[model samples]
Target: MSDEAAGRRPSIRDVARLADVSHQTVSRVINNHPSIRPETRERVLQVMSDLQYRPNRAARALVTSRSQTIGILSSSSTQYGPASSIAAIEAAARERGYWVSTANIEPRDPSSIAAGLAHLMAQSVEGLVVIAPQMRVFRALAAQPLDIPYVTLQSTELDPTHALSVDQMAGARLATRHLIELGHRHIYHLAGPQDWIEAEGRMRGFLEEMSASDIPTTAPILGDWTAEFGYYAGRELLRVRDFTAVFSSNDQMALGLIHAIRDEGLDVPGDISIVGFDDIPESAHFWPPLTTVRQDFAELGRRCVDVLLGPVGDSAPVPATIVPELLVRSSTSAPRPL
Candidate 1:
């Protein structure tokens, strides 16, 4: 019978009875004791589900003094990069038998950051994952050192000790080098917003590569990391076919650039080659497919958890940087024999 039908909420005792295990075993399963047999854990979990048993976090905390939860503090949670990282963290946490609580706040406001941290602290989270894309957020975190362990997804010498990140600059350099190697000396760059750490890193990489090749360049068109900006930028750049290639800081802008090129009756890699960053899912299916950099967000997420919580049963040292990969697709090619 359902717990509702029984006229009382099911208890740990009820779960132990149904699963044919002792109450102690049930408690171990509840607390994610690593030594429990797989079959026994499954049986206990099944029974808990069948009885609609919800462990009282309050009572559990009182007894064990461990909340067994991880808090995620994100500033740009709505963006693809931050969102992907968050999903990866949640999956890794689940594998370790832990829960995740996320708090999103405006990165610019110190008060908002304080409030967000406070909200997470109230849950007694064992650790924290800070997805602070903005430098100010990291500065705020530095000012108020966290009581529990925390990890940040930043690499700009801001907090290298506690940082777990993909080498964004390296990824950008790879993209720029590909275009230059393709024999396209006249290359333009579509960069993200000025203040964003990622945008700055990518622009710097692009500039470094261009300068290293002894290629003179014009100012890059600053973009908002949107298809709309890319489209307009592409349209404006097309007015004078001065450049044979353009490297976009992100895929959305590349998509817009592609659309603008097609609208002008031009071709990708034929009239101009395009390369983008962040191989979002739809990039592969774009008209000619986008050539871009792929950030291993899933692995990044795993490392995020491992740094603060340590590997569940393994002993792998946390890496300084998870290098991104360049995905060369149909969007780029040698600038049509000059």
Candidate 2:
């Protein structure tokens, strides 16, 4: 062999030759096939290590006609929900002897999302999972005819046939109901981006609970699910002196709202109670621990994969909704009697 070939990364054929085994045997060993003899397996494994051999995933997929890789199409993979969900999906996929390929789409436009989906398809992904939380994405999905197996994460009104989501509405209800039990009658909701499904679901849940209890359903205060928006909204809220409690769509907004309220000389759980969603890692460390809903993104990821790989059969598409739990903390308290 030329020096150039010798210096290149070791391939399956190299290991096969070194171990005196056929290329098929090496492939089986790489895939952990059960039929390989124990002694032969050890020999092949040692040769692989000596050669520093690594299997080419693409080549393997070509051979087996199974990529064993799922495609994830998402916007803002760095954000709390999508980031956590992606990590969870990766872990879950690894456990199932599969891999993941992620494509981060910009602004979650229908065209851009469609392009990302096409890119994943080109990679020969076995399944697709879309993590765009906006209603527009669902509309885009409706516009396209995706014949491949796919699922969506927490979309607003997705086709029941191809979508799955965490139960954001249920989580919001849990938060609202908890506050009601604490004697908070006039609750204010700090909503996330008006365009996001999660924001809408949480708002809907809060309204539904209030309506069921014969409480008024006022329009929610809109924010962009950012600490800056929360802070700004909180400052504006100080001008209206009527609300007893506030429920933010996510924890970042809650944190900013808390800061804003404190800056206005109002004490948390003393002057006004507060609650947030997502149960972010830092919620416990806030000035007053944040009472929030915990959405298990990891579980969402695992279940998405399950639905994608499992037999859909003749069963109609049924969207899976994972319920979140409410974590009671120091941020909430009984409202002072007016």
The TM-scores, one per candidate, come to 0.86, 0.89
Candidate 1: 10-residue stretch with minimal lDDT: 154-163
lDDT of 1 at 331: 91
Please write out the lDDT profile of model 1 over residues 191-277, one tens digit for every residue.
998767888888988999999999988998999989999999999988887888999999999999999999999998788899999
Clashing pairs in 2: none
RMSD of each: 4.1, 3.3
Per-residue error at 61 for model 2, in Å? 0.4
lDDT values, one for every candidate: 0.90, 0.86
**Quality of model 2 by C-alpha lDDT:** 0.86
